[model samples]
Target chain A: MRNIKLTIEYDGKRYLGWQRLGDSEKTIQGKIESVIEQMTNEKIEIIGSGRTDAGAHAKGQAANFKTNSEMARNEMLAFFNRYLPGDIVVKKVEEMPERFHARYNVKGKQYSYYVWNDPIPTAFERYHSFYFPQTLDMDKMTAACEKLIGKHDFAGFSALKKTKKSTTRTIDDISIEREGSMLHFTFVGDGFLHKMVRILMGTILEIGAGKLELIVIDEIFETKVRENAGETVPAHGLFLDEVYY
Target chain B: MRNIKLTIEYDGKRYLGWQRLGDSEKTIQGKIESVIEQMTNEKIEIIGSGRTDAGAHAKGQAANFKTNSEMARNEMLAFFNRYLPGDIVVKKVEEMPERFHARYNVKGKQYSYYVWNDPIPTAFERYHSFYFPQTLDMDKMTAACEKLIGKHDFAGFSALKKTKKSTTRTIDDISIEREGSMLHFTFVGDGFLHKMVRILMGTILEIGAGKLELIVIDEIFETKVRENAGETVPAHGLFLDEVYY
Candidate 1:
């Protein structure tokens, strides 16, 4: 048995998300598994590092699967590229250690959300970025970013009311950059809860727009209540940029 | 009556090019015209700098329309943005001279074609770029670009068989740039014939792939036949980058 690791890039616009749900083949994982099943002629389960929400794109998503096929890495890569849809590409494939697990062995992740701040919508980025026509205060948003950094209880930011897993996660860094009318938010963290990034973006954008006070960040962190946070931004603007092992 | 010039930007993925076709609301010009007609309650024909082929995007496409409505520029800009589809945007709107015509009072144009040279597909730029999974010889392609410069009868490059209009047009400049796995070909010229940019891309790409020699450019020029040139590339990779007046 050989364990194969795959680096994937996908445009998540048409996908139901990364995870395979039931028999529905509208998912990113289902698409890849179907292609692999056709190539290997075997039923095999593929494990993803984590689930990206529906309509959320990924640049370097990691996955691994155990297969008994004798195909070489280059051959499998070629096969996947040839068979997989153009929107979902297997960027790299390699033989991994027998015990390697994509989900359990994930060390960290990086996510970036794009915001188009101009009054006029960006034609090309309409699907990929959040279009906020209102003016934003960059200075206030930058100041708020400092507060979001470091380890904190992100329960208020998640979509779920409660999770069996601990909600306390370390946000290594959060950087907000502005280039012309485009604002980019980059978040590096050990792990993220469901819709945590989107919620945080919503809250941060509200603060930038002066709708919410900057002190709301502290209130949300201490209370650990979902209602205390701002609205959950759309999944289209979020991208699972990188997954580190 | 006030003449309004609009600096337009569009994704073109969902558009049937920039021209307003008969009863087709899918075109970029048709969408904008509909919005204007709704706002002003009058049927106004919006003239574009030129027609981009179907599936061809634009960053700075210029258009002009005559309207009797005394709407301010800012108000008109907001109204168009609100009513237009998300994939199409009016970046800027300004009052123009009554005689200023988008198609007639022309100067030059800058068009760009994006090529994803790597085997792996781009996650974000899927619809905006062409995935050409072949090793390109930049040196050979550059040498060919030099030959393609200056005033030439580009009848061989166009898809149209016969036209009364002169086929001679001066190419101001052609520059090929590579950034990572993406190759951008920017062309500045007086005007392009039907599918001229795409045909040139196909021919140049063939030269880069070593399938066609650099001397084929000269032979195609002398023959003045479309059959002598390479295939016409896909329209999705082409962009009307800028329209200069």
Candidate 2:
């Protein structure tokens, strides 16, 4: 069997998420697998690096699958692109070593969230960004980002509950900057729990809007309570930028 | 009657152009008039700077309408933004002098067109740009732009039928540059004839792709025949960037 790595990009507006569910055709994984099955005439399952929430987009979602079919990498990429919907594109395909796994071999991930910090929402960015009507203080938000870097248990910023798996993740860096009319937040970390990036964005935005204080980050980290954090922003604003190996 | 001006931004994917045609309500002008009538309880019509083609977007399309209602400018702006669909946004509302006219007062206009020049089309830019998989020579495209600057008879570049109106227009500038993976074309002119920018883009791209020679621009201008020009690009990639008065 040949181990192949696939880099995927998708507009996740119409799909459920990156994971497959029982008898549901709305998942991105299911859609890709179905297309691959048609090309190879074999049952195949692709392992994604991680799952993105519904309505969240991906610029570079990494996945890997082992296949018995003797097809060239270029041919497979073309076949997949031809069969997949316009919203999903297989960017690149390469043969990897037999030991490579998309899910278990991940070293880091980078995510970005866009907030349109303006009173009037832009028509072009309506689907790609979150429209926040209230004015946000960049100074406050910049200050709040200081508390997020480094290794810490970010259970309070996530939606996971009573999990036996460890919730401690090492956040390497966090950057907040304005991109034209939108505020862009980028995170580089080893891994993130469910809704962690969004929750962090919501809390940072609230702090910028003066609804929360700087000390709230410390409090949430200490308490490890999901309710202690701020709102979970809409999924459309989040993007899985890249999955590292 | 008090005259007020509005600056609008729209996605244009769902609109049937900017002009109101007969009884059709799919136009951007018709939509705004309907919303204004509902708010003021009086029928109103807006005169736009010009008509944008169907499926073409706008960043700052200007329009003006007269109303007897003494609604505050800020209130009117808020009302339009609230009632309008998410794809149509009213960015600014101001009380203009009674002599101000959207169409007649235009001193200049700016338009931009985007072309995705890459092998893999990005899923996000599918609707916003025209995807040309072939590589292009920027030097060739830039050379073609020089022939387009200044005043000339653009009859061959337009879609106008036999008419008494002057086919000559002064082009102040034309710029072609790369913006990330996309090629951006900008035109600043006294005014543009129907489908002039798109047709110019089509001709210029052909030159870049080596499909058509640069001397064809001269032949088209000298002969003033529409059939001598290259293909007219799609409307979705065109945008009315600004209308200067």
Candidate 3:
């Protein structure tokens, strides 16, 4: 058996996310798993590095599945591209070691959020980006980012009410960039909890818009309560950028 | 009375070009005109700079209409952006001179074409760009562009069956640039016949792919026949970038 790793890119506008839910065809994982089952003639399960939410896009999502078929890497890649929808593309296929796993072996991940900080929304990018119709103070947002760049319990920033697992995670960097009327937020971290990035975006944008004070970051960190954080920004603006092994 | 000059941008994926046909509401012009009429309580015709084909996007499509309503420019702009569909946006609304017209007073136009020069199509931009699997020779395409520049009768490169008006047009420049797996084609010209840019793109890409020789451009110019030229690329990749007055 060979452990095949896949790097996938998808526009997740219509997908229910990267996990199969019963037998719904609107999920990214369901669609790919069904295609793989058809190709291999066996029940197969694909392990994603992270399960992104519905409507969130991915540029380099990593996944892995074990197979016994003796097909070339390029052929399997082409087969997936041919069978999958146009919005979901398997960018690369690699035969990994037997012990290689998609989720358990993950080292780090990168995520990006797009915000259109203009009075009006853009026509083409409205679906892919969040339209924040308020002027953002970059300095205020940058100050807020500084408060979150370290190992901390981000439980307050997650949408999950409670989890038994450890909520502490290491965030190596958080960069904020402005290009014209678009604000790009990049998050590099070891792992993120459910809705962590969206809530973080909401908290930072609220700070920049003067709705919340910079000290709210400290309050959230200390409280570790979901209600203490800002609202979760829409899923469409979020992107699973990359997964590193 | 006010003569309003509006700059518009739209994702033409669901639009039937920019012209109204009968009572169909699928056209961009029809949608905007109805919205304007709803706001002003009067029927008004929108004159677009060019009648783009179905699925052709526009970044800066110039249009104008005469109105007797006493609404301010900003108010009208906001109203249009509010009422029109999310895919269509009125970027700017200006009260122009009495004699200003969208079509007749145009000085020059700029168009852009996007080609994904790779084997697999991009998931995000599949609708906005053309996927070409063939490897393109940038030097050959650039040389073909040079042969077609300046004053020339581009009648052979049009999709129109026949036109009584002269097909002579001035092409100021055509630049081809490659960035990674994407090719960007920019065309600047005083005027263009119907489907001229699409045809020009197809011809040049064919030349770059070694399917057509460099002399084919000169032969098409002399022959003045639509059949003498290469195929017309799809309408989705074409973009009306700007209309300069």
Off by over 4 Å in 2: none
Candidate 1 chain A, run of 10 with poorest lDDT: A156-165
lDDT digits (tens) for residues A1-245 of candidate 1? 99999999888999899999986478999999999899999998899999999999999999999999999898998899888888888889988899999999999999999999987788888788998988889888888888998899888888876668888899999998888888899999999988999999999899999999999899989888788777899999998889988
Clashes of 3: 0
Q: B1-245, model 1: which lDDT tens digit per residue? A: 99999999999888788888885588999999989999999998888999998899999999999989998999999998888888888989999889999999888999999999986767667788888989999999888888888999999999877889999999999999999999999999999999999999999999999998898899989988787777899999999988888
Error of 2 at B75 (Å): 0.6
What is the fraction of true interface contacts found in candidate 2? Answer: 0.75
Interface RMSD of each: 1.2, 0.7, 0.8
**lDDT by residue for model 3 (B41-154), tens:** 999998999899999999999999998999988898889999999999999999899999999999999999999999877999899899999988889999999999999998
Per-residue lDDT of candidate 3, residues A154-232 (tens digit): 9999977777999999999999888988889999999999999999999999999999999989988999877767789
Better of 2 and 3 by TM-score: 3
Q: For residues A1-245, what per-residue lDDT tens digits would candidate 2 score against the true structure?
A: 89989999999999999999985489999999999899889899999999999999999999999889998888988898888988999999989999999999999999999999887888899888999989888898888888888889998999987888999999998898787788889999999999999999999999999999999999988998888778999999999999999
Best by TM-score: 3
Top candidate when judged by DockQ against the true structure: 3
Model 1 alpha-carbon miss at residue B198, Å: 1.0
Worst 10 residues of 2 chain B by lDDT: B21-30
Cα displacement (angstroms), candidate 2, residue A102, comes to 0.4
Q: Give the CA lDDT, 0 to 100, for residue B182 in model 2.
A: 90
